[model samples]
Structures are given as structure tokens and as C-alpha cells.
Target: MSATRRQMLARTGAAGAGIAFTGAISELFAGTAAAHGRAGYGPLVPDPKGLLDLPKGFRYQVLSREGENLRSGEGKVPSNHDGMAAFGGKRGGVHLVRNHENRVTAKIGVPTVKGLTYDPAAKGGCTALALDRRNNVIGERVAIAGTAVNCAGGPTPWNTWLTCEETEDKAGTNGYTKDHGFIFEVDPVDPHRTGAEPLTAMGRFQHEAVAVDPRRGVVYETEDAFQKPFGLFYRFLPKKPQGGRGSLRAGGRLQAMRVPGIPDLSSIQEIGASFDGVEWVDVPDPLAVRTPIRHQDFGPKGVTHAQKLEGCYWGGSSVYFVSSFARKAEGSAGDHYGQIWRYDPSRRRLTLVIVFGPSTDIQLPGESPDNICLAPAGGLMVCEDGGGVQHVYGVTRRGDVYAMARNRQNIGTPDNPEWGEFAGAAFSPDHDTMYVNCYAPGTTFAVTGPWHR
Candidate 1:
């Protein structure tokens, strides 16, 4: 049996996943207005190390960094750290499974362990980190190796990590010996349990992140294709639902979402707007051997498409997903900095819960909201991936957005300081710590402070 939906969300600190906490989309904008004042910890204080800035009384420690030697001595830490998940370990410790969104050209890649390597020629995979109660790194090693573009993924109901490949690159195209673009299950506590095999039945495409429905044992997926064609929202029904580790490998049926008259989600701008009688359409070819899943035919009614569909998570009995941003110049139906949508399985309905901006103001609180997780304190913690200063923002249940942390790391010269987008923001089961990733000059951080409860 699987964990109940509330138990899963509670474990993940996703109880606040419903963006419209007050039950009104209008409250989101009102909260935005209230954001002018402070909603979270007062303001961020600069870090002397120039790595990360947090509010007073809060501190961050670098748990892992690119090119650093791994504790296992298998190899150095890989580059392009992306999505991650935290699980409770023995004696008040925490275990994290992190993804490396590397390609063939990366200088340091996940080492090819004998049984863990999926394709020696490929340079993307996942790594596991073991930390004690004090947030000290106790053990670290490659969880899965030899994949490609391992991007954002989700945690399972039975204590496992699902790592996704964000590329459609084929075996021979870029020195990859095996076909890329599939989800792989990684056990945080035991590396050997991974088996390093892709779940091919979930469909082939540029997958971003996933959210598992513990109640129904369903997996909701998001695609992050850059341009014109965009991407589709997907759900996979496993043959053996919630059978614990490695059960997804058994097989599954893949399907895309359809919203009746709405061909593109970007076209819907009104807040709180929703569509009923939402349906799922079967993909003619889940493998995408002949045509990509989104490009495949779904008849005249067509299927719903969204630009830059990224972060996904399950909470409040609904599947919450994000559209990082869309631009009209790039062939989208409309333009917006960010959007958060919720699909309620019980109601068979989809609603637009949060809308960021159509404005170009870099200082806006909601600019290009990427990886998101509901905070244990009853709000959403959003990672800003837009231009200008990079920040980890906090959005309250009432919709107020505030800066919680800032990337002060300057990887470049004073004339041009480079800051990477934050990804994989998740909280511990005890709600005492939060873990996130810095995409460039890859670094993993464990943040601790006085959080609202």
C-alpha cells in the first residue's frame, strides 16, 4: 500500500501547495501588494563569503560543490547540479539525492561505477549525500551514472528519488551509447537498488520535474522544451502502483492532458480562471520512435500545450505545476513572467492559481518563478530564475512574496558577476532544514534559520 496523500504532502512540507490559500485568486494580487512591506524575515544580510545571503539569524553551509572530491573517492563531484530531494536518515540525519544536468562536454562527470553506470559515454546522472544531525557531510557518492541532462525530479511515497533527463538526444548524436530522455529511480539509502535503468514506459521527451500522487499512485510530469512547439503535461499510470523501490520499472501507460477548447495554456490570463471536464488523451507512441510526443497527433480537439513547463509537485489533492515564462516573440500565445496551475484529480478541473507578471521589471517579486515547494510555515518557497539579482523568495498562504535568500556568489570579475538560478528547493521531514541547488559553479546548500511554523 502507499502513503495517504496528506501524509506524503506533510512529509514534504507541501501542505501549503495550494497557491490560493485563502480560496481566492484575487488574494494573490492583494498579497503581492502587501509584499511592498515584509512578509518573511525582514531582509537579507550579505554573506561575507560571498556565496549566499540570508536574513538575520539564518546561515547556510556548502554541502557540496562542483569538482570537489567525493567522500567515497569514486570521483569528484559533477557539474551542473540541478534538482534534489531530502529523506530522513538514521539518528536524526538527512539523505539527499541530487541530479547533475551535465552533457558530454562537462569537465567532471559522474563516475562510471561497475553496476551503476547506465552508459559510460554519457556524462549526466545523480549523486547521494549523507549528512548527520548537525548538517555535516558524512558520506557522498554517485547514485546513478552515465545518463544525459539529468534535470528536476520528485520524491516517491516509499523513500526514493526519481531523476529525470531533460534532453531528447539520441544514442549516437552526442557520444551517448544509450538513448536518453527517461526517468530513473534512485534509492537514497542504497546505491545498488537503482539498477541504473531508465523507465522507458513513461514516454521520451525533455522532462523537467515530476510529482507523484500518493493516493492514486500516479506520476505527473512536466516538459521544458524552449521554443515554438512547447511541451505537454503528462501523467503515467504505473502497472504496479506504490510497490516501493523499483516498482516503476514494471511498466506504465503514458497520457497527455487536454483542456477542451484551450489549445495553449498561455492564452488564459484571467486569475482564478478554470476549466472543467478536463481529460487525458493517450499517446500513440510513448517511446516517440517516429515522432515526438507533443508533435504526435491527438485529433481535431487537440491537446493543451504550455511554454517552458517546469517544476511540478503534489499537494492539497491536486497536481501543481509551473510555466517558468513565455514570450510572444518566441511564438507563444501570450507573454508572462510566470504561472502556477493546479489540476484537481477529484474534480477533474484545472485552475490558474498564480500569475506573476507581463512586466519587465527585474525587481518584481514574482519574476520567472522556477522550482517551487510549499514551505512548512504555510506558504510557498519559490526560486527566482529571472535576470538581475538571483533570490530564493517566499510566498505566503495569503500570496505575499518576500526575499528569503540571495545568491551572492560572484563567479566572474567585478565588471560582470555571474549568478546561477536556484533549483531543487526542498525541506526536511522534521521541517528544521531546507536544501537547494545553485545551477552554475554547482553547489548544494543546507539552510537553517528561525522559520515560521
Candidate 2:
């Protein structure tokens, strides 16, 4: 490794020691390296030649493409697809709910919803597709009414998908008079006829994803803001008892996490420390209900920020979060390395699971680990959000890394390209099939594996 990278590893090791121990650091490095080396032997699938690489015996077919005519005959194809969730309907068909993370791009087509155009220049939105057992599209519907930059979100236990808008604006001209960031719930089967009002009770922030604890009605949320000193991490507790569902706007208690033991390193030393655990602080009223301007009160010490926290999931009795743009040393340009953190609600503890960056021994060249999905066999599938040679990677709980699929056919310019990999990674209810979405080409894929690993 390079000298700079070695130094980075040393610093990361020290941080890891502070969080857990040096032994954990060694295991993290060794496990990831070992996993990458053994990737080719784990599972074999017959992947498409020259399109992307996969294990032997795995095959994929196109499910939906941008601008393709659906049951509604809406238009050609949608663009900037991101997070997705799959639900099995009573009719034995699977319903895939997807997010379109479109920015201010005019080339991508927008949904035809009246008074629901959040941004005139916004191209991406959210859609739900009903697929038969054979993975064919039975129907399609646009769920959320008006929103922009719809990023990665999680599925609720109540059988509803939470779609998050990842934009925070000072000037609210983008069809969002209330706030730029919020979460919306949509029924996968009936997307077009969604409720008129949004679930505003789920605090307003630059939301990236939401993970709900099935036992507790507590919802964990991640933020993707960095323009300020610290980005915020939040948890919402519904006021009503468990098993109650209607709209997120009904009522809930919003609270921000505060790492008290670890000082605010950015302000004091111009560098943040790599601490492992976090403490929670309740924020009674995020948006002052009494005021018409909708001002947010972040409490006294304010919110503690981390690297750009993008994707999150609830697993192993803890919530896992990924920092896409983690700093290498104290003061360095954001590196490609990302770190996965596990937050245990039972113990109220935060643990640093693994760190990914060029500085570390194991490196992933991707810019951001946008969205993540767990495998029934015990591992994670991450969506790459960098440029050139994008792919979908599988990582084990033991820190093993493998490149499961690549987007060779989806390589082109940012806009108006043949294929560009995005997010929306979901597994079928039976865990027998995998589904993925491409943003540049605006398409979805259904793949079947031979299961003889």
C-alpha cells in the first residue's frame, strides 16, 4: 500500500481501538481482504457475457425500462431509480416499490400528476410495479404525489414503503412550501391513488433512508447533509400505541442523537474523532408548530454530524448505517472510504462494524455506497454510486467482500445514456430471485440464481 494509505490505516486502527479494540481493527482488515480473495468461489451463476460479471449459473432479464408502456399507458420510461421494496400480494404476485433519485435534469420524463410537480426541472420520482410469479410487470403506478430527489428509504412492518426526499432547501420554490426534506408512505399495489396529504410528522431534514424496528414503533433515520458543521441523525417514536397506522403526520416524538462522551472534534480541533458509541437526546418540537415559517429547533448542543450517511438497514437486532464520504485522517479531503456502523437499541450503544476506503487495507473505489439490501443467506448487497465501471457488491457479516454484478451495458454519459447503475436492490419474498434498477437507462432487472454454492 502507499505511504499515505498506510498512515490512513494507522489512524483508522486507532479510531477502531477507541471504539472497540485493536483486535477488532485487525479482524476488520483481514476479514475484508480474505472475503475479496474468495469471492469467485462462494456462489456460481451464469451471468450475461460482456454485460457484467456474476457467479456461474446466475441469469438476469429486463423487467422494466424507462419510457416503456405500462398497464396505465402513462409514457415511455422513468429515470434516476434508487431505493426499492418488494411485497407479496394476496394474488401470489410480487409488488416492487421503487424510488427515482432525479435531480434538476430535464431530459428524464416526469410523472403526470396534477399539482404534484415538486420541481419543474426534476426528472425522477417514485413508482410501483406489480409483477407476476415469472417476474413480468402486471401493472405500474406512481405513488408519492410531489417530491424531488427521492432517494433510498426502508419498508415499514405495517406493509407500507417510506419514500424519502433527499433535498433540503432554504428557498422553498420546488413544489415544497413546507420543507425540502420529508418521508412519504405509499401502498405498493395502489400507487397512483395515494392519499392527498404527506406524512409531515416524520421530522423535516435531508433524509436518506428510514429503518423501523418491528418490535418498537421507533423509526431510525439517516441524513445526507454536510454544508453545515454537523449533520443530524434522528429517531421517531409514534405517540399512539403500537400497531396503529394512518399517516406519519398524525403524531410522533422526534429526537436527535448526541455523542456526549466524544467532544465535537470538528469545532475544537478542526478534525472529528472516530468514536464508536452514541447517546440520544429528545427534540420535543423540531418544527415550531406555533410559527408559520416552520423553523426547526435542534436543541442546545445541536446535532452531531458524521460522514455523509446514505444507506441504513435494521439487522441482527441493530441498525446499520453507512458513511459514504468518510474523512481519512483528521483533516483530509473526503476519501472514497465508507464505514458501516451498528446501533443497538436494546443496549443503546453504537458499534463501528467495518471501515472501507483506500486508506484502509481493503478499498472500494466507488464514491458512495448508496443503498444496501440484506441477503437471506447472511450478507449485504451494496449499490455503487461513483463513475465508470459501476457494480453491485456483496459483503458478508464477517466483512467479506465480493463483486456480485456489474453494469457494463449501462455505461455512458450521466444523462441520456444507455445504462447507468443506481439503487433499488430488493429480493423476492421467497428469497429465490433478486431485482435491481438502473438509473441512466431507467430500467429494472430480475435475476435468478442456481443456488448451488
Highest-lDDT candidate: 1
Write down the TM-score of every candidate.
0.92, 0.80
Each candidate: RMSD: 6.9, 5.9
lDDT at 339, model 1? 84
Q: How high is the lDDT of residue 414 in model 2?
A: 53
Tens digits of per-residue lDDT for model 2, 1-453: 321122112233423322332223332233222222233233334344545456667778788777677566666557767789999876668998888876655355556565444444445567788888888787886665456678889998877788887776433555444445667777776654444345567766678898888788788898876553435677888775373346465678777777665423222111122444567676665553442111245456555667577888876467777776555364323443566666778777665555553422222333457788865455567787765556677654344455677776645555744446658888888777888887666778887784224
The alpha-carbon lDDT assigned to residue 165 of candidate 2 equals 77
Model 1 regions lying over 4 Å from their true place: 1-21, 24-38, 358-365
lDDT of candidate 1 at residue 321, scale 0 to 100: 95
lDDT against the true structure, each candidate: 0.83, 0.63
Q: Which candidate ranks first by TM-score, i.e. highest?
A: 1
TM-score, candidate 1, is 0.92
Worst 10 residues of 1 by lDDT: 1-10
